[model samples]
Target: MRASRLRRAFAVAAAAGAMVFSVAGTSGSAASGMPAAPRLPGVQADTLAERYGANDDFIEKSERAARRMGDTARADHLAELAEPGRQFLSFDPRDDGLAVEVLGDLAHADRVAVVVPGSDTTIDTFDELGTRYAALAGGARAVHAEMRRLSPDTKVAVVAWLGYHAPRTLSRDVVTTARAQAGGAQLRVFVAQLKQANPAAPVTLICHSYGSAVCGSAVENPASTAAPLDNLAGIAVVGSPGMGLRSASDLAVRVPLWVGRGADDWIAGVPHASVSVPGATIGFGTDPLSREFGARTFDAGRGGHSDYFKPGGLALHNLALIGLGHGEAVSHD
Candidate 1:
């Protein structure tokens, strides 16, 4: 009886989300006429400089294409990305776009944090001032900066990874696991690449909101053809809906998992349950912050969903500690 009621509730929620948010339009501009980017470089510490140069060239070309297409906003944004000091491991200004930006010296860093953003994240909105997705880049910068402040002698790097077509928050897609599954696969591949580049560095996935679902999928489903991610130090999720699993033990990897939710986060209202339907799962199950999930919980203060990475915030400080493998120092809820 309980299971039946849960399924019915999921169906209603899914239908409501579709009716309210599924607009009859594409997510973003396709950037169809943009020039092709250079081939991504092989994952190697020695090729870091070469990869940055190639991505820089691609950014310049993309900037020109955006200008030609009369998209001043996009062109201006690309121009900033192409600046001399900025470094990007990868850039693709097509479709919703994908980019992996490094904030510190990745080649020399022994600890690395890969920041995965949630819904509504795209190239155009990467660092846009008013959007919630702005936290994607902002959070990465905050984590990087906080890590430096916490342990200046330690070598750490933060990578802002916008590598998937994130679903819109109001859309039906956000309620399903399809996007998360695909993103998880991509994340797995990217982590493999990261390991290949620097085998000694311990990588931690810092996921936010929907991105936590992606990380959950990534850790839950390892590629059959690829080796396991042995260098994964930990995973930290903030403002999450759910991780598509019943419990932390369900995770395929046995790494340390940590979760934090802001005191006033709207996500706390989301139903933490999943129900199987005809073609897909309707929700992500098991709230990471719940005692039943069996993951460490952290104090996120009184901010809302988008404030986890706010400078000097408790959440940001704990995130840095987790990413740096100093889990003992994170403040619990």
Candidate 2:
């Protein structure tokens, strides 16, 4: 139950079989100087299902998981989360294995949050993100419900993007090497799918831990030949070491980037970690507020890494604020 144990368990699992989906970082291919991905124009929500056809398996899986939860409200909430499947990316079963779940009416929502969860994350664990083996409807679902409960009237969409191949160790195999290249390519394509679902809808890329690494790499080193998509309203990274860029301005999206780390995050204590990342070459001692990195630094109190998105956690509250365009004012204990 210790943080170190949890982090280690995840590392072992990922190194073995992709860790299902780590709520943590991967050793990106960027560490070794591999080129990023080719950019694809984003997709609109309306025609996504008709265009891509990537949602059947995900929809069936989510529905089955919801029924087993034994909680109607959660089942409904999960159903809501998976609703986005009908809107974006066509639920491509063969497409890089990225998972998608949507809550609220994507066609009408003013603000949308695409949640890219970190290590040990998976499509089936859509609700819990590896909290417990029997957690069919645990952690992720609870907070997702809280999001709706806090503001049912607000047309907010919660996406559990458990897709993308993550690293097994803190090594460069998945993260720096493959994830950096393949992740950006998939994301580029996904963004196009999302835009097709709903154009001009403000997108807030909410990334966690290793997911942050994916986000940074996607933006900093976009595909060599493609034009960039529309600006994301915002980018939020919690419990992050640093996005792959030397500074936030380096990100291609031309959006405001924000970062926070739960005070107790053991990742901050890991020495020579990011510095070890090869190509993108981010080193340790990365300050979220470094002017060199154009992001706004958020002070996320002492919740530790995994605790960032937990109920009543300061980081989660911050995420809600970022989600609502309310800025980072709310603070949870």
Candidate 3:
């Protein structure tokens, strides 16, 4: 059985390498043909209004640049982003773009949930209103809405964090930990900054699919300073492949970790094992929902991978409960 597993791992690795080579030859770099954006502000809650203005200016400038370059679709999208009442904590137009948007009153919230997305999530597809990828932003909004519905008196906020260059599903990078490692470093910094801005509010990380690997990496490798993530409430991963760890106990922190998966998620077929190559480790090991991994399981219902955040779904309801620090109320499998 061990030999068979190893052979399967190598076969997948070989296929991934071939795909990587083919894509490298045909596709341009992530940052290629992107318009330059303005500098972003430091993460400071007191200066959020000014920061929002700065990001709006950045979006407008990038919009003009895109327009000049004849990319009307991108320019139109930027125009929508620059519209009034949209609050972006950070915005970078270059390199597949990165945006961190708040869905509620962040300064006054008692609880904050950061929604980290999976693969194929980009600025262009961030909130494609009527599609599965809509969860990139729509999921955050749904969580915020559900939190309000569940506890009207509680102050809550949800952040749609598209702060990394997610790999395409078909790419070799999807099976490797390189992107997750880099993204995990960035997530740690961002969370630290967020804690500094709002020391009173507890933050929860809600990660999906490959985003689960990013969350796992972030938890596995914490900064070596005191209270690096002081007010982290909890972490929940849905539709995950694996968390790049042998067990939940391997996590660096002692916080509560939850895992859930829809019954029909295609990710179920992916190998939950890692193999070390020359310089990188391929695949995230240990299924999060497995007993050996030792994570609290939640009922994700019968939906597919993208339906986790569907309105009125069990997954979304449980996710909202978890994000609100109401783990006791979350339904178990």
Candidate 4:
């Protein structure tokens, strides 16, 4: 993503200055609770009130949600995730009583991939932008094909988790650890629902951009639950800011982890992994891409933040590997 785009992602109340980040540990005074969401797409007025009157209407049931997922036009979750004027954070809607689409036939399948997209991204972005303009997901799609291509025994269902409050543009806050902690509770709930829906399936979470932050916080218990973040064959984070924990080892789940950045990614240059909490601030001790993450590295070339998903990119190719339980790094270009 471009610096200008990054700035636009963040709806910061303060004017741009040198973004100050907290260097302290996760114990920092960051609000370890849920972050609030702004109104949905402030631009268009819902002059005609939504039909559902109950608050729970905003949240859909899992059974119906799964059907919605398979039908693209009925994609309420996507609209909620990218609707401007709403909070830019994305999480599993099933966790928040919101709607979510279920894909993949896990009963007979062997693998699954939950794709989490970053800022300025949408359902259209992956299918439209990445397919024609860039080579992202080229490899991701290959992995899907490879799953069926190489192993007919495995069935892969990839969910585009564009759910989280994105940077709106790119504010240090949007890229920090605070949001993770804030949204942790909801994330856990979402994962729980996903697992509940498909108990035996092995799940892999693929987080990109600020989506990584959601993963970081999800493991830490933003909602303060004893049910730890469990289940997972792997986690792949690309163009990430920082998991804020110093190491992926800190994550409650110990699945194989992978991290890589396009050398040209400006997000890697963002100064402090400063995450502001309610009273104080927190810092992700070290770079998440470090050995601490317990993940192998991939070469994204000069592709910036969003490049990993670009077609024919190694990052996208490797994502297929990770998603398919093939941890070995692969080349796309």
For all candidates in order, the CA lDDT equals 0.84, 0.55, 0.82, 0.51
Give the Å error, residue 285, model 3. Answer: 0.6
Q: List the residue pairs that clash in candidate 1.
A: none
User: What value does the lDDT take at residue 301 in candidate 4?
Assistant: 73
Residue 97 displacement (Å), model 2: 4.4
- Candidate 3 is scored at a TM of 0.90
Q: 178-235, model 4: which lDDT tens digit per residue?
A: 5566555555665665565456667787777667777776764234544445656777
Clashing pairs in 3: none
For model 2, give the RMSD to the true fold: 9.2
TM-score per prediction, in order, is 0.92, 0.67, 0.90, 0.62
| Strongest candidate by TM-score | 1
Error (Å) of candidate 3 at residue 83 is 2.8
Candidate 2 residue 73 C-alpha distance from true site, Å: 25
TM-score of predicted structure 2: 0.67
78-130: candidate 3 lDDT, tens digit per residue: 78788889888888877467899988888888999999999877776677645
Kindly indicate the candidate among 2 and 4 with the higher lDDT.
Answer: 2
lDDT of candidate model 1 versus the reference? 0.84
Off by over 4 Å in 2: 1-43, 48-54, 57-97, 132-153, 169-177, 221-224, 272-294, 328-333
Highest lDDT: give the candidate number: 1
Q: Give the range where candidate 1 is weakest over 10 consecutive residues by summed lDDT.
A: 21-30
The lDDT of model 3 is 0.82
